[model samples]
Target: MKRYALQPLVIGALNPESPVSKHRQLRAILRTHAQETCKPGDRLPPERELAEYFDVARKTLRQAIDSLVEDQVLKRVVGVGTFVAHPKVDLQAKLTSYTEEMHRRGMVPAARVLRFDSVPAVGNLAREMGLAEGTPVVRFRRLLLADGTPMSLDDNFIPEHLVPGFLDDEAPMSLYQRLDERYGLILQWAEDEIEAAAATVENADLLKVEIGFPLLRVTRHAYVDDNLIDFSVSVYRSDRYKLFVPIQRHGMRPPRYTKITQT
Candidate 1:
């Protein structure tokens, strides 16, 4: 009654006599197609059409799609069809700036400074930076982007006494680069904490994600020896970014401060 066809949706023919199951065979075909022929956000054909073209039951086709979806090779919307998922970036947990990390991946990095102001350090902000309650601090918010895609919203705070006239300084792409090259504030040690979170309304708007989307919350405390220099909290899109941390046993020397390269 109904007919369906695909020119290049799936490559070659499914091996009916092969040892692999039908769904797995279908998955391999789909995977190959997605990798070779399709781009991220490219939607696959309808389930019925795919099932018919592959000459398999709808259940088998659905199973194959589901497997890919779980692997993040594909993503499905409620009313929308399944689409190829965007590639995720793996950022190493080293003393590296966002600009350096993106450059290592052959990506272009940019930042849009939303607000920069001198605020009185109060409450936890004062205690965190080891500054007096009424001390003035530089607070700036930025939207970090990689290849024109929104990646994170970063909020950084620094004691104004340490960086006097910072607002008048030329805006740089990387804060770490600026601190290292200009101020001789090479950070010797730092701490980073990551947690799972949901996108808030404000965050979602900046990050270009739906409300309540999954996010990775990262907080950092960085210092030059005993002097706290920078404290930051960044919210990242989980679907597009991942943290890569290396683990080692004791007796290994602690990681040292890496020199920031000027770009």
Candidate 2:
């Protein structure tokens, strides 16, 4: 409910003679002002006031603000003015559950089990799980949330025989934990492929983002002792999440030989 007053120094005329377009100039100035003066959750001045201060038309001002909103540098509520956005989460490529990762970031993780049922595996599902066609597989469609905000939509397929009673109502937040505790199936490793994607209507509704919004799709195959346990596809909000991978150089040395006199 707190409001932030725009800084007076940001009120200046745009350079018309400059090569940059008026909207682009306005956007750059606003971006700098927001970065320098605005704190996260600080509401920006009203659109009319910003237009007047920048000496630009409302439409031009709107275009500039829209760019920031798309970049997640600013957030606009219907009635409330725009506010600076919080930092995006950096997700590491690790074999940890979503709940564990969120908890490590000091965020409360929650999951809504949208769909949980057993279905016959075919095509890629069968091949990925190394199961015969028509094998019964438990499918989980879940929406993952962090601090009550939608973060990702997960669709997972697991061999049903490996996880008996998993579709029951009393399901744990962390499926890996459940598999380890109840089925003694340890997840030793996983391979993940990450790519950019657009949010589909169904996923956008669950994630609370606009349809066709930018998203990050992650396809994963988890294993236990070289046996596939589950294959999952997760779509994350690109504006809210960033994938991080750490690389290290492997130390190697060519063969070194000493002359016979060195003995």
Clashes per candidate, residues 3 or more apart or on different chains: 0, 0
For model 2, how does the per-residue alpha-carbon lDDT over 164-246 read when each residue is reduced to its tens digit?
78877575789888888899998898888888999888888998989999988989999988888989998888868776554
**Cα displacement (Å) at residue 78, model 2:** 14
- Model 2 steric clash pairs: none
Candidate 2 Cα RMSD after full superposition onto the native fold (Å)? 10.8
Q: In candidate 2, how many Å is residue 70 off?
A: 12
Instruction: Please list all clashing residue pairs in model 1, or write none if there are none.
Output: none
lDDT of 1 by residue, 37-124 (tens): 8988899888987888888899999999999998888989889798888877667666778898999989899999997889999999
TM-score for candidate 2, please give it: 0.70
Compute each candidate's TM-score over C-alphas: 0.89, 0.70
lDDT of 2: 0.80
Off by over 4 Å in 2: 1-42, 46-82, 252-263
